[model samples]
Target: MAQLAAARQGTHSTKTRAEVSGGGRKPYKQKGTGRARQGSIRAPQFTGGGVVHGPKPRDYSQRTPKKMKAGALRGALSDRAREGRIHVVSELVTGDVPSTKKAMAVISALSLEGKVLLVVGREETTSWLSLRNVPNTHVLSPDQLNTYDVLVSDQVLFTKAALETFTAGAPTGKSVKAVAAESEVEA
Candidate 1:
């Protein structure tokens, strides 16, 4: 919920009478001939007046407890896993450079449809570039994973390294470095 709220761009704004331009002087005298009281043209009653009770820019971020956030993520992943929507792949390779053909082949092999979330332990440029163009496919690092993305995706594909990172508990610098070292040895 916090992630979803933060995603919203609350940039809406409105100009008040003081902020509106070209309303420095009064339009007419206070006592008018068969006319209502007069004020600045920027008054709300005027046609070119400033907005009233208008929206303003604000931050929609919510402060969720760390435990609650962790629990929610675990629950989401558990639900998906129970539903058999989580697939753990041995590895996601696309040669030394990114290749759309290789990425497409992998997607086809997995038979992934709709929204697919591919989680990786590290930021591999080749993998990211290769899968970026695939429709309905999103490649994200394990640390970037959240309950919203997990729940929204039709299928969640976790690379072996990513699975290990999750199973090892919260991601830390030491753990990430260890994972990288392991991948290097394997490669």
Candidate 2:
């Protein structure tokens, strides 16, 4: 997944002499006046000629196994949980419309500092809207959740429904009740 994020593609390219335009006719005949022979203007020896041994586009992405990616996600979750940096709320936003004030209030209430990753369920549009406007807070659907977001955030906040969806798919993981309990104990 991380590799997908950073394919960091190499796009450098230069046309080869054969591919360069205006090179069909020979620049000078083989038995020419005393001057170096040039097959065409596009030949490497000529000015404005094509390059040799130039770089072309390439993919730097590596194939990572599904199990490895899953394990990485689990590891990120476990680290945050161990530190008690995870929080869950019954609801993300109370109002029907987008409200930055309400979103700020939630963060203040949770006393979360630094970058925060708020995982909301698919149906929680208002919650996403309200919170996304707040700086330093990132809103994500449970399906969009990944190890990068989990590891980067100072605190991970999830609505109840989103929490269920996140942990439900993990293997050898804590129950929601246990998660909440563990968070409280550490906090």
Candidate 3:
């Protein structure tokens, strides 16, 4: 199957430019000070040089083509799936809403232990509450998913919505648990 690109929205703006300061005036007077020929105090030589503080503020946001974005997301998901780090779920709904008990039950039912990264399709008050109390369950929306989180844990779980959001670019509409089940070899 064709997969998305491995890049994480890398269509960065090429317009970004660094701002430099200092180096305008001459420092200490030449000739007899017995020291170096002084130029601007901001000459980067004097302790107070122009901008020892570094560049000023600017935008870091990047723009990628729609096709690229979708492709990259798909690729990332596929790579993780191929590595056996991804798990797909039918849904994440629990009878007790977002109860810790319900969350624990799901974990136990699924036999998910250790650090689990749960990628939900959208936000949910219950999933937040339910998973929050769990020791190592990290919950986040599909949009927030990233490589760092993927690499941090041994596995990744995806709700059906999250999977769709990842593979098909769909918006999450309800609460669902997408869990990454850790292996016994690591435990």
Best by TM-score: 1
Stretches of model 2 off by over 4 angstroms after superposition: 1-13, 31-35, 55-61, 170-187
Candidate 3 is scored at a TM of 0.53
Residues 87-109 of candidate 3: C-alpha lDDT, one tens digit per residue: 66766665546677765666667
Order of quality (lDDT)? 2, 1, 3
Alpha-carbon RMSD to native, per candidate:
5.5, 4.8, 9.1
1 or 3, which is superior by lDDT?
1
Residue 99's lDDT within candidate 3 is 76
Write the residue-wise lDDT of candidate 2 on 1-187 in tens digits. 6566465867878888877878888767887478876678888877878899988878767776667776777678778888988888888678688787887888899999999999899898888778766889899987678788888899998888887775556445552211223343233
TM-score of 2: 0.77
| Clashing residue pairs found in predicted model 1 | none
Candidate 1 Cα errors over 4 Å, as ranges: 171-187
Q: What's the lDDT for candidate 3? A: 0.57
Per residue, candidate 1 scores C-alpha lDDT tens digits across 1-187 of: 7988988899999988778888888777777467887678898888878899899899988997766777787777777767777887776774687887876787779897889999876756677778877889888987788888888999888887777775666544433221222222121
Question: lDDT per prediction?
Answer: 0.75, 0.77, 0.57
Candidate 3: list runs displaced more than 4 Å.
1-43, 90-93, 121-124, 133-135, 142-152, 160-168, 171-187
- Winner on lDDT between 2 and 3 is 2
